[model samples]
Target: MCTLTLAWQVFEDAPVAVAANRDEALDRPAGPPDVYRASPLVIAPHDVEAGGTWIGVNEHGVFAGITNRWTERDLAGERSRGLLVADVLETTSAADAAAHVERTTSEHEYEGFNLVVADAEDAIHLGWDGSLSRTAFDPGVHVVVNVGFDETFALPAERRDLGERQAESARAVREALEPRDDERVEGWLERAGTVLGDHEYGVCIHGDGYGTRSSSLLAVGERTRYEFADGPPCRTAYEPVGIEGQF
Candidate 1:
């Protein structure tokens, strides 16, 4: 059981928003976000592997999201999950941070995984299968799943329609927030909820066997905000929260 779903790193006039849903769940682990938490700003319901994290944010406005790098099992490393989270938050730049993670990962053994790291200036995607590494992300919105393919891959006809729908939803979200009122944060949240309404990205739910254990909505930028709630409905009624301590 694991969480699988799409995440949006939204930048509004007020604050950046990280909104996501937990697709599935296995055994709930004991952690800071009990729901989801890692060292410092790293926050996710659980690790991608037994010891790896899937999504995390640092107090420094550094954020990362990891997905299984689907590939032949031949490539992997021995890096601990905790180390991965720690390395990114402590590093100053995405390139330096990626290098630190890649170097350490090469020495250790682990499963295939893709990590998305972002700071105020840049966002990077790192694909690793233990033996080889590739970086494939720039700025702007990108979608990731449990599959391996660059952004250039042509979408199937059916998927193209789905993509259009998601894009439209995303656009609507952007348009609705054009005014960016402080009180409208709630409206923005509602719009986000509406955009994701009834859309199940399968990966997150994973065949009912694994229901999302937790879900998170995060916003970064000048003032970072993180909101967490249980999965399925993916609510945000709780207080608008911030990561405690420094990265």
Candidate 2:
């Protein structure tokens, strides 16, 4: 299981932030970010065999990522989540991408998952549990977990207000990037720690057994950057690695 977070500047020309963690069998051969000929854009370490990605961006100013929802069975065989992300980035506008994913992947049998996609024009969130549901994003801060719920799940009073705090902190970072201020950038970076402080597995072994196995933060601008960590209060950017092939 994994976690994916995004922060977007409400008043900037095209400022966006993203963070994610790629959780697999732990023994899978994964590469870092690199440019490929088919898509011919920089993509995060993608599992060629699996045909999906944790995060990636194209020169056309499009970005996309995926988070696996904790469910009873594996969904990999039903549809290729990575390919879905890449397809959206390469071919569609953010406004209609979610529907495309839903319509295309509906026939395949899968567990469940959420996808976050963005472009200069719009951003979208999609939740699929063999069925498809989606919501368009307004300019601001938002977070997506593996729970298959929208912002509603983002707040839970019982968690010591952790979810609310994280959401607020994420918004702060987005505001900081509006003017692209260094101080604000630093401040946002610092606050990012607080937002991700309570990182937990997407699936709890003691409970659902699908707790978050990793977390990530990604930002896209003139250039795209990514940071990943095991638990919340996540810090550090990962070096890009290269992957080959295209679907």
Candidate 3:
């Protein structure tokens, strides 16, 4: 996931709502949302090149997503960060998942990343840029980009400058996004799709052989609801995925 907007504990019925866009190279192969794990019923799209996912959710109502944190140089991580998202999803609850991520990431090596793991009970943001840090934030609307919007971390001058330049596109999108009229998470997802697709906000990118590739909307409450757009949200329509009421 390149950019993620989460409305945690903002709705009356649904405690979590998310609108996320995955930006990647055009040639990178990927599949739409599907059943990846059977026991707990994990739903996520596959990064065909890496055999992992950028975002996913489980039957336990746990949601996990990752966004790359821009660095001065483009370097491949020893391990794909998306796999970390998958690992955290295996846990039953958000807090447990978060603790697992903290321990695992501290022991392993991954490139710069901003990770969000959350369920109705807990929401945690973990940022890594050669170092690791964890943050707990209040419930409300939050936007995370490559540089990590609300989840801040110390950085070298060069790296920070690079982030300022590269992360502006995602920040622009967040600024231009309008609030949803209705309170329901389902309604917010529909409204988010409209604005998220608009190039005017820089949410939908048309770059040189690289741009926004896929989108996901999730609402977690008594029952979980998920919808996915296989292609760029601007040109593709979202369809329901997983079991309608659960899973």
Candidate 4:
């Protein structure tokens, strides 16, 4: 499970902004953001183990991300959910991506997950547990955790505390961005970095076996930008990644 927040058409100058903190076992092997050699040309981090990705943006100006759903099940050798975001990036618009998630009958082979696909004008959240649910995001701020949007999905009692923390973090982020003076992407990135590192909860979660690995901030406007932090936001700075080359 991870933490992700989205601001859709929240700013006049910048139509879309997303902030995410990816939590996983520190031992998982992955690479930083790079141009994904696919039909639509995506920029995302490479999940070496699964040969997929967690977050990415395509040349069509569509940005996508996936988060694991908290459920009691073991799909040990099943298909990787990390690739879902990249798969959605293959489409040209958020509507097409949502359609892919809605009609894809093959998703049952994978574990529970939430996939968010967004373009300049549209944003969609597709949730798949045993069944599927879709939410067309309105022009406002939205937060999603592993339990699904607004914590509508079931979560074990032991993990409920962490889930609450995630919800609070989302509210904190929204408050921080709602009435800001600066409109530049750089300013948003800097503010996002601070909020992503909030230690009250797992926004920058730390534990014996699992913790935050990296943080990503994507801004879509006149020109799209993706900034990645190689390590935890508490100790790392975000760097702008180039999506032109394979590296």
Q: lDDT at 164 for candidate 4? A: 67
Model 4: lDDT equals 0.76
Per-residue alpha-carbon lDDT of candidate 1 for residues 165-210, written as tens digits (9 for 90 to 100): 4344434433433434344444555554434333442323434455
For candidate 2, which ten residues in a row score worst on lDDT? Answer: 201-210
Q: Candidate 3: which stretches are off by over 4 Å?
A: 72-76, 151-162, 165-182
Per-residue lDDT of candidate 4, residues 1-247 (tens digit): 6877777887766677888889998998999988775666788899988888988888777878888876666554266777667778789898998887776635445787878888888988887765677888888767677876643556657788866665666556566655365466567767778878867544787888788999999887667777899888989988888753431
As a TM-score, model 1 comes out at 0.66
- lDDT tens digits, residues 1-247, model 2? 4445565564243366665545465445555555532554545555667766667766555677887664444456556677677677665466666667776775665556678878767788877765666777877666565543334443323543544454444344334333334434334533554444433322211124333344444556654555545422334333333222321
Task: Estimate the lDDT of model 1.
Answer: 0.50
* TM-score for each of the candidates: 0.66, 0.67, 0.89, 0.89
Model 1 CA deviation exceeding 4 Å by range = 1-17, 23-25, 30-52, 75-77, 80-82, 149-190, 193-197, 200-208, 234-239, 242-247
RMSD of each: 5.8, 6.3, 2.6, 2.7
Error (Å) of candidate 2 at residue 111 is 3.1
Residue 191 shift from truth in candidate 2, angstroms: 4.9
lDDT (10s digit) by residue, model 3, range 1-247? 3778888888877787889889899999998888878878898889889888999899888999998886554545788898888898788998998888779876887888888988888888888877777888678777787877653533456667645644565556555543456557777778788767877656677789998999998888787888999888999998888667545
Model 3 scores a C-alpha lDDT of: 0.79
Q: Looking at candidate 4, what is the lDDT of residue 81? A: 78
